[model samples]
Target chain A: MTSPLVTVTDLKVHFPIKKGILAKTVGHVYAVDGISFDIMPGETIGIVGESGCGKTTAGMAMVQLTPVTSGAVLWKGRDMAEMTRSELRALRREMQLIFQDPYSSLNPRMTVRQILSDPMDVHGLFTGHQRKERIDFLLDTVGLSPGQADLYPHEFSGGQRQRIGIARALALDPCLIIGDEPVSALDVSIQAQIINLLKRLKRDFNLSLIIISHDLAVVEYICDRIIVMYLGKIVEAADYASLYKNPRHPYTRTLMSAIPVPDPARRTRRIILKGDVPSPISPPDGCRFHTRCPDRMEICHKQEPAMRRFGNRHTAACHLYTDEQAEPVENKPKAKEKIS
Target chain B: MDQKTQASILSIQNLKTHFFSRKGVARAVDGVSFDLIPGQVLGIVGESGCGKSVTAQSVMGLVPNPPGKVVGGKIFFHHRDLLTLTVQELRKIRGAGIAMIFQEPMTSLNPVYTIGNQISEMFRLHKKLGKKQALAAAIDMLERVQIPSPHKRVHEYPHQLSGGMRQRAMIAMAMSCNPEILIADEPTTALDVTVQAQILDLMHRLKEEFSTAIQLITHDLGVIAEMADQVVVMYAGQVVEQARTVELFQHTLHPYTRGLLASIPVLGHRTLGKDEDLVEIKGMIPSLYDLPAGCRFSNRCPKVMDMCKNHLPDLIDMGGGHQVRCWLHTREMIS
Candidate 1:
C-alpha cells in the first residue's frame, strides 16, 4: 500500500495567556493540546467542532500556518516543525490553505489576473504569455469567466469571490488544499455550487483536501473521513459511512444528533447536551466531555481514555469501549456503576 | 383546519417592497403574501437577496426610505393595515404589538448600554413604568430567558456576555412587552450548533408560554424544518411555494424548491459521491432590479417551459392550503 500524503502526530498548539501591564505569563490557553490524524493522497479529511474547539488551530498547525507547541506534522515523512524557513517555504508551495471569509481574504485592490499570477511570479513557474494563459486557466478552472480577469475582487459577488479564492489556492498547482470553513459564509444555493466545484476539482486534480467546518452536513457530504474535536482533543475519527451510521463517542453522538436534518417527516431522536462547552483554558480533567456527556462513567472523571479502535477503521476515545473482552454490541454501556 | 377559525395575528398581502437606488428600482419583496397565526411558527426560507428579511421589515414598518419603500401591499397586523397607521400610532404598536430581533446581536444591541439598561428601556418606553420598576422588570425578563445569575448579567454590557447569552438578552428584550408577534431574522445563524439548538429550543418554549406568533426568516432549511409548522419558500423576492412543513418537504411542487431540497447535504444520508454530482439550481438569483418578465426563477429552473419565459404565474392554491407559483401546476389546474 502507498504511504499517506500527510500525517499529524500529537500536534499541540498553546497560546500563552498574559496578565497585567508587565505582560507576565499567567497561564496558557491550550488551543490544540494534542491531536493526531492522517490524510491519504486524493482523500478528503474533515475536522469539525464548535467555536473554540481548536479544530481550526489543528488545521493551521498541520499546514504550519500556526506555530506548533509540541509534536510533529510529518509531510511526506519530513517533520515540518524542525524544517528551516526556506525548507518550509518550499513545502508551502505544495500545500495551501483557503480562509473562511472570502469577503476579507482577497485583496480589494488587486485585479483577478494579478492575484492569480502573483504566486506564479514568485515561484517563477511561467513567464510572459505563458503566465497570462495560466492565470486565465485558473480562473476558468474555478468556473469564473476568464475575461473577468481584469476585474477587481469587489466587482464579483460573494460566490464569485469564493471562486476567485479557489483559483488563487490552485494558482501554485498544489497537491493539497486546506479550506477553513470554505462554504460557511456563502448562501445555501451558492454553497451547493462551491461544494460541487470543490468535488470536481479534487477529482480532476487528484488533490488531497482537509476541509475544516462547523457545518456537519457540508462535512458529511464532501469528506471521506471525519475527525470530531472537542477542547483541543480528538474524540472520534472514522470513515464517513461508519461515523454517520454508528457514532461511538457520547460527544460524537450528541453532535451528530444536534444537526437538524432537512427532511421534516423523518424525525430522528435527538440527544441535546445541556450547558455550554467548558473553557479550554481549564478543560475538565479526565475525559474533557464528561461534564456534558450523558453516558459518562465514574472512571471518566478520573482517567482520560485513549483512542480505542473498533471495527471498520472507526476509533473513539471513550470509557464505554474500555472492556476489550466484551463484545461491542452497537457499543453501548453495559451497566451504570455508582460513582465513589 | 379552516382558515377563518384559526385567527391570524399578522397577514401580508401582495407585499411589494422596493429599494430605489440611483441605478434602478430593486424589487426586494415582490408581491409576496403570508399569514402568521397566533402560536404558529411561520418560516420564510430563502437564500441571500431573496427578500425574507424585507418581508419582516415591511411588517414592522421599519423599511428605510429614500432608498427603500413599500411601493405596494398591505401588512395587516390585527386586522389593521400597518402601512396606513401614522408613525406615532405605529410607535405605540411597535414593541407592544409587534417585536423583532435581528441576526447580529452585537450590531443590533447598543454597545454603550448595559444589558439591564437596554432591557429596562423596553419596559420603560412601552409599559410606561418608572426607572426602578423597569430595572426590576428587566432582571425578571433576563431570568425568564434562562440567563444564569440575572442580577450580575444584567449589569454587564453586551460585550461581556457570550454569543448565546447575548442572544438570550435580545430575546428577553423582544419578549419583555409580551407582543403578539415576533419577527426573528436569522436569530441563530451566527451561533454554533449547540447554542443554536439551545436558542431554538428556548424559542419553542417561549412560544408555548406566550402564544406569540413567530415569523422566522432564515436560509437554513434544517432549522425551518425543526421549528416551523408552516413554511413559505421564496425566490428572487417572490413566494414560489407555501404549505405545511410536512407537506412541503414530502411533496415539493416548484422545480426551484425541489432543487433546493435536493441541493442540501443532509446528515445521516448522503448519496453524492466521486462519480455523482449534487443537484444544483443552474444560475444565480436574477438581478432584483431587472427581474425576469415571467417567473423570476425561469432562468435557473431545470424544468423551464416556453410559457414560463413570457408570463408570470400566479400562486395558485392546490388544495389543503398548498400553493405553488409555476406554469406547470397552473396549467394542470386549468386543464
Candidate 2:
C-alpha cells in the first residue's frame, strides 16, 4: 500500500471556559482529544458519531479551521502544523471543505458563478476567459447547466444548493475534500443523488475524502473505512465490512443497532443506550460510554481502557477485546462479577 | 371488514393548495387527496418541494395567509367539511379535534413562557378550565409524556430543555386535549437516531393508548416503515402511490416508489462495490411554479412513455387497497 495522502496524529482541540470579571481560563472543553487517523489517497474515510461527539471539530482541525492544541497533521509527508502563513494559504487550494448546511455555507447574496469563482480569485489561479471557462466547467461537472451560474442560492432547491457547494469545493481541483455532514441536511431522495455525485466525483478526480456524518447508513454506503467516536475518543476504527458485520466496541454496536431497519419483518434486537450523552465539558472519568454501556464492568468504571489493535486493520478501545482480559463471551461476565 | 373500519376520520379530496408568489403561482399542493382511517398511521413520504408538507398544512388550515390559498378540495373531518367551517368553529376544533406537532419544537414553543404555562394555556383555552385546574392538568400531561420530575420540568422554559425533552413537551402539549387526530410533520427529523427511535416508540405507544389517528409526513423511508400502518408516496404535489406499509415495501408498483426504495442504503445490505452502481433517479423535481402539463414525474421516470407525456395518469386502484398513478402500471393492468 502507498503512503496516505493525509495523516493526523494525536489531534486535540480544546476550548477554554472563561468566567468572572477578569475572564480567567477556568477550564477547557475537550472537544477532540488525541484523535489520530489517516486518509489514503483516492479513498474515503468516514467519521461517525452522535451529535456533539466532536466529529465536526476533528474535520475542522484537519483543515486548520479550528486551532489544534497538540498534534501533527502530516499532509503528504509534510506537517501542516509547521506550515507558514503563505504555505498554509497555498495548501488551502488542495484542502477544501464542504459544510453541512448549504444555505448558510454559501453566500446568499452572491450568485452561483460568483460563489464558484471566489476560490480561484483568492488563489489567483486563473484570469479573465480562463476563469469564466473554469466556472462553467465546474457548473457542468456538478450536473448543473451553464445557464444556472447566474442564479442565486435561494433560487435553487436544497439539492441544487448542495451541488453548488460541491462545485465550490472542487473549484481549485483539491486533492482532499472534507465533507462535514454534507448529505445529512438534504432530503433522503436528494441525499442519494448527492452521495452518488460525491462518489462519482471522488473517482473522476481521484480525491481522498474524509466524510463526517452521524448517519450510519450514509457512511456505510460511501466510506471504505470508518472511525466511530464516543464523547471525545475514537472507540472503534475498522474497515466498513468488519465494523458493520462485527462491531467490537459497545458504542459501535449500539450505534449499529440504532440505525432503523427499513424492513419491518427483519427484527433485530435494538441495544438502547440508557442515558443521554454526557457533557463534553466534563466527560466521565473512565470509559466515556460506561455511563450507558449495557455490559459495563467495575473495571470499566475505574480504569480507562487503551485502544488495542485486533488483527491487521481493526482497532477498538474496550476492555472486552483487550489481551489482559482474553476470556470467552460467557466467562467475560464472570470477570465483571468478580470485579463487582 | 366492517363498513365503519374503512371510514376515514379525515378525508381530503381533490385538494389544491397554491401559493401566489411574486414570481408566479406556486402549486405547492396541486390536486392531492388521501384518507386517514381511525386508529391508523398514514405516512406521507416525499422529497422536499414534493408537496407532502403543503398537503398536511392544507388539512390543518395552517397555510400562511398572504400567499397561500386553498383553491379547491373538501377536507372532511368526521364527515364535516373543515374548509367550510367558520374561524370560530375551526378555532374550537383546532386543538380539541386535530393537533399538530411541527419539526422544530423550539420554534413552535414560546421562548419566554414556561412549559407548564404553555401546556395549561391549551387546556384553559379549549376546556374552559380554571387556572389551578388547568395547571394540574398540565402537570399530568407532562408526566404522561414521561418527562422526569414533571413539577420541576414544567417550570423550565423551552430553551432549558434538551432537543428530545422539547419534542416530548411538544407531544405532551399536542395530546393535552385528547385530540382525535395528530399531525406530526417530520417531528423527529432534526433529532439524533437514538432520540428519533425514542420519539417513534413514544408515538407508537401513544397511538395504542389514545387510539388517535395520525398523519405522519416525512422524507425518511426508515421512519415511515417503522411507524406507518399505511403509506402514501407523493411526488410533484400528487399521491403517486398508496398502499399498506408491508404491501408498499414488498411490491412497489410505481417507478418513483421503486426508485425511492432502491435508493435507500439499508444496513446489512450489499454495499455498492466498484462494479456495482447506485440507481439514482436523474433530473430534479420540476419547479412547482411551472409544472408540466402531463404526469409530473414523467420527466424523471425511467419507464416514461409517450402517453405519459401527453396525459396525466389517474390513481387507479390495483386491488387490496393498493393505488398507483403510473401509465406503465395502468398499461400492465389493461393488458
Candidate 3:
C-alpha cells in the first residue's frame, strides 16, 4: 500500500501493579498485548472497544506518552521506540495527541492565547510578532474569533474548549493526530459540530488520524478502516464497509448488535453478551472473548485463534473460521437458537 | 395499551423552571408540558442546557431553592399538585411514590455508605420498615437488577463495584420501594454499549414487574428508540416535538428532530453513502442564559422563515397524538 504512514508491530504495554512499602512489581496489567495495525497516509483508522479495552492506552503508547514494555512502533519506517530524546522531541511535532476531556486537558490558569503560544514557543516555531500572527491564524483556523484568545478555558463552553484543544493539536501541523475520545465528553449537538470540524481539518490539512472511541456510530461516521479490540487483543480488523456489513468474529457481531438502532419501528433484537468484561490484569485463557462469545466452541476455550483472512482486507480471530478441523455449524440453526 | 387503562401517573402542564442567575432569569424549562402514563416509558431527549434534566428535577421537587424555582404550571401526581405540597408531604412521596436515578451513579451514591445501607435507608425512612426487613428487601431488589452475588455486593461500597454494577445498584435502589414513577437521567451514559444494553433490558423488565412509570432523560436516540413508548424532543428549554416512539422515528416533522435523527450514524445499510454530509444543524444550541427571541432553533433551522424569528410556534397536533412545534410544519399546513 505504498508504505503506510504509521505501522505498529506486536506492541505491548504492561502497567506494573506494586505491593507493600518496597513497591515491588507483583503483577502487571497487560493493557495492550501484542497488537498490530497500520495507518496509511491520509487515512483515518478507528480503534474501537468498550471501556478498559486498552484503546486509549494504545493511542497514548503510540505518542510515547505511555511507556511501551515491548515491540516496535515505526513512524514512516523509523522505529519510534529506539529514537533518542532529542529525536523523540522533534518527532512529537509530527505526531500529536488530542486528549479526551477538553476541560481537564487545558490549563485553567492560562488564557487561550498563552495555551496556543506556549506550544509554538516550546518547539521554537516562531518569535514575537510572528507568534502573535501564528496564534491568531490557529484561532481562526479552529473557527474561533481573535478576541477569544484572551479568554480562559473556564470562560468557554465545553464545545468551545474542545475547539481550543483541536487548535492546540493543529499548532505544529502534525501529520498524524491521535484523538482519544475527543468528542465523547461533549453534548450530542456539540459532538456533531466537533466531528464535522475534525472531518474538515483532516481534508484541509491532508492528515492521517488514529481516532479512538467506544462509540461505534462515531467511528462509523469518520473512520475509513476500523480495528475492534477486546481485552488487549484485536478481535477483528477490516475496512469500514466490510466490517459493518459482515462481521466475522462472534464478539464483533455481538458488539454490532448491541449498538441501539435509532429508528424505533426498525427495532432489531439486541445480542446481549452473557458476562461482564474480564479483568485485563488476568485475562482468560485461549481467546479473551470466549467467555462472552456466543459462538464459542470447546476448541475456542483451549486454543488461541490467530487472525485469519476473511476477505481481501478483512481479518478476524475466531475458531469458527480457523483451519483446525471442526464441523462448521450451519448459520440457520445457530440463528434459531439464542447463543447466550 | 388501552386509552382508558392508561392513566397519567405524572402530568405536567405549562411547567416553567427558571434559574435566577446573576445576569437574568434563565428560562431552563419554559412552558413545557407532558403526561407520563403508568407503567409506560417516556423518553425526554435534548442537548445539554435544553432543560431536560431540569424538568426531571422540577418534577421531583429537587430543584435548589433561592436560585431555582418552579415558577408556573401544576405538577400533578395521581391528581395531586406537587407544587402546593409542603416539604414533609413531598418528602413522603419522594422515595415512596417517585424516585430519581441520576446520570452519574458514583456522584449520586453516598461514598461513606455501603450499597445495602443506601438501599435500605429508603425503606426505613418512608416505609418505616425495620432494619432486618429493609435489608432483605434491599438484597432482593439488587438481585432483581441482575447484580451478581447480591449478598456480597450489597455489603460492598459504591467505589468497589464496577461502573455497570454501580449503575445497576442505583436502579435497584430507585426501584426498592416499587415507586409509581422512576425518573432516570441519562442512566447509561457512563456505561459501555454492551453494559448499556443490559441496563436497558433490566429497566424494561423492572417496569413490567413493578408496573412503574419511567421518565428517561438522555440525548441518545438509540436508547430512546428501544426504551421509550413516547418521546419528547426538547430544544432550548421548550418541547419541540412529542409523539409515539415509532411515529417520531418514522415521520419526524420538526427540523431539530430530523437533524438529530439524521446526525446519528445507523448500523447496517442505512447510512446515506460515505461522502454524504451528516445533517448537522448549522448553529450551536442557543445559550440558556441569553436565548434569542421567538424560536430558539430558528438560528439553526435550515427551513427557517421570517415568521419563525418573530413568533414562537405552538405545539399543534397533526392527528394520531403526534405534535410538533415548528414554523415550517405550520407554514406547510397553512399553505
Who wins the TM-score comparison? 1
By summed lDDT, which 10 consecutive residues of candidate 3 chain B come out lowest? B268-277
Candidate 3 chain A: 10-residue stretch with minimal lDDT: A331-340
Ranked by DockQ, the better of candidates 1 and 2 is 1
Please compute DockQ, using alpha carbons, for every candidate against the native two-chain complex.
Answer: 0.66, 0.53, 0.61
| Candidate 1, residue B197: lDDT | 83
In order of appearance, the predictions have TM-scores of: 0.95, 0.94, 0.94
Best candidate (score: lDDT): 1
Candidate 3 lDDT, tens digit per residue, B1-335?
33422378888889999999898999999999889988899999998889999998998888998799999998888779999999999988998899999888999999999999999998898789999999999999899999888999999999998888899899988998889999999999988999988888899889999999999999999999999999999999999999999999999899999989877766653244653455676768777887878788888888888988988999988888899998777777889
User: In model 2, what is chain B's TM-score?
Assistant: 0.96
Model 1 in CAPRI terms: which quality?
medium
After superposition, the stretches of candidate 2 with alpha carbons farther than 4 Å from their true spots are A109-111, A127-133, A147-155, A324-330, A334-340, B1-6, B271-275
Query: Model-by-model lDDT, in order?
Result: 0.89, 0.88, 0.88
TM-score of candidate 2 on Cα atoms, chains taken together? 0.94
How does model 2 score on DockQ?
0.53
The CA root-mean-square deviation of candidate 3, after full C-alpha superposition on the true structure, stands at 2.8
lDDT of 3 at A292: 83
